[model samples]
Target: MRDRHLYLLLLPGLLLILLFRYAPMYGIVIAFQEYNIFKGIMGSEWVGFAQFARLFRSPDFYEIMRNTVLISLYKLAASFSLPIILSLLLNELKHLVFKRVTQSVIYLPHFVSWVIFSGILISFLNPIDGLFNAILANFGSTPIDFLGSSAYFRSILVISDIYKEVGWGTIIYLAAIAGVNADLYEAARIDGANKGRQMWHVTLPAIRPVIIILVILSLANILEAGFQQVFLLYSPLVYDVGDIIDTYVYRVGIQEANYSYATAAGLFKSVVAMTLIITVNKLVKMSGQDGLW
Candidate 1:
């Protein structure tokens, strides 16, 4: 009877996943068909792997793939360790007021919608009269159009994404750090370990499992380079450098109505992401770490 209430509480979440997540997976068949709106799924002509073949043969395929992988890798490299570092630094703060205020200020950006954030970014980065250019003018520098330049676009994407997300990412690390045994720190201090040494030997090792799990999960989305952020930030001027798989699919599928072709591209991303998650999880398990199983 006690377990009955817990099972009842779990039912809604299970139903939601089954209805909205698993049920929709059936649409993946559209990627293998010449889907027509009028004919619908059942009547659509099956074209086997023709859509996937076409996607591979397209001239833009390699460019899109390169841009996607490079951007995601850049973000992973630049932003992954920042939260861990921030959590460590924040943990060392002695003043509660300063720590709380600093955390609140940083975490504020995560709640802002991408649409609003993009607008703010455009206004701030504007070349002629924007804040950045205004500052440059004082330094006697020529105003540079950041968003319009391919050279600067990718950097802007990475930096802005990091700014918005780094604080939120710290939450998990902070929680993990909080759970570390206090006795370990005392033991480290008795061993003549300084603050840095304690963090290295006690705090970081205690949080290693959480870090490993998060890293493995992040690998699953290696191809997903933030669709909403990229879509809102990119322009034709920076397409060569800024376009990713998701944006490419949006342009081809939604804008051009090549649904099957676009679906093939999406399906390709999904398959690769799934394979990555499984492979990385297995590797983590082999290393004696807990995995998503």
Candidate 2:
């Protein structure tokens, strides 16, 4: 049967999935264990929900959770809408050469490491002699250290993340737009629909499914503010707003060697993420569209 060949074609990927993905899932037992280096994972004593209890009791837990959710929410708002906006703007460009060049330049930042990007941002946002501060100084305003200030750190994080990813995100929308029938646009134009109205009536409706799917996926990652960006850019002073669950886990688990506590924290985040994905998927389906299922 044709299906047999298709299964054969997928065999390698299936094997890889079992080996790399499912195999590592066994380590989740550490979340319920009093993990110790000498005792090892299997030898460690079981503690059930004790670690989770301690994690919840920690004073910093609420702060970290708030930071994670708030930052992720900001990113969700900015990231979800930016690509759609960019795709619409790009679609309006009739010049292929200019469009391609602009896309290439914007997508270029995505390939740059967060460490490198953070350094660039620090330099640009420096209080003294920085581009932003220099411009402010010219207008008789005092210099402000954007990166050092807690009030501005989250803003910087969201803006930088948007700048890095929005172009790459637009590629999918652009592809969806390409699949939309050109005849719809022609018909709308003949019916007295302007460019904006044509987009509202035709192009957007056509790509609504893709937008819905991506938004659902984005909500699923509502806890995952970019780890590398935060780790690279944040200092002790700005940790109030910049510290995320991932960074907290890294510091506690890897740096401080509190494996059991870190595992508990990580497991909590995973559970929440899974719950969000499932809930959003159901909502999307109920709204009458294809979903992640």
TM-score of each: 0.98, 0.95
Identify the leading candidate in terms of TM-score: 1
Per-candidate clashes come to: 0, 0
The residue pairs in collision within model 2 are none
Residue pair clashes in candidate 1:
none
Tens digits of lDDT, candidate 2, 1-293: 86999999999999999999999888899989999889898799999999999999989999999999999999999888889989999999989999999999988998998889889988899898789999999999999988889989999999999998988899999999999999999999999999899889999999999998898888878889889999988989898999999999999877999888888888898899889989999988998899987
Tens digit per residue, CA lDDT, model 1, 1-293: 86999999999999999999999889999999999989999999999999999999989989989999999988887667999999999999999999999999989999999999999999999999999999999999999999999999999999999999999999999999999999999999999999999999999999998998888878888999999999999999999999998999999887988889889999999999999999999988898888887
Q: Once model 1 is optimally superposed onto the true structure by TM-score, how far is the C-alpha of residue 5 displaced, in angstroms? A: 1.9
**Regions of candidate 1 where Cα sits further than 4 Å from its true position:** none
Go through the candidates in order and give the C-alpha RMSD of each one to the true structure.
Answer: 1.1, 1.7
Model 1 accuracy (lDDT, Cα):
0.93
Cα-based lDDT at residue 145, candidate 2? 85
Q: After superposition, how far is residue 178 of candidate 1 from its true place, in Å?
A: 0.6
The CA lDDT at 55 in model 2 is 90
Query: On a 0 to 100 scale, what is the lDDT of residue 241 in model 2?
Result: 93
- lDDT score for candidate 2 against the true structure: 0.91
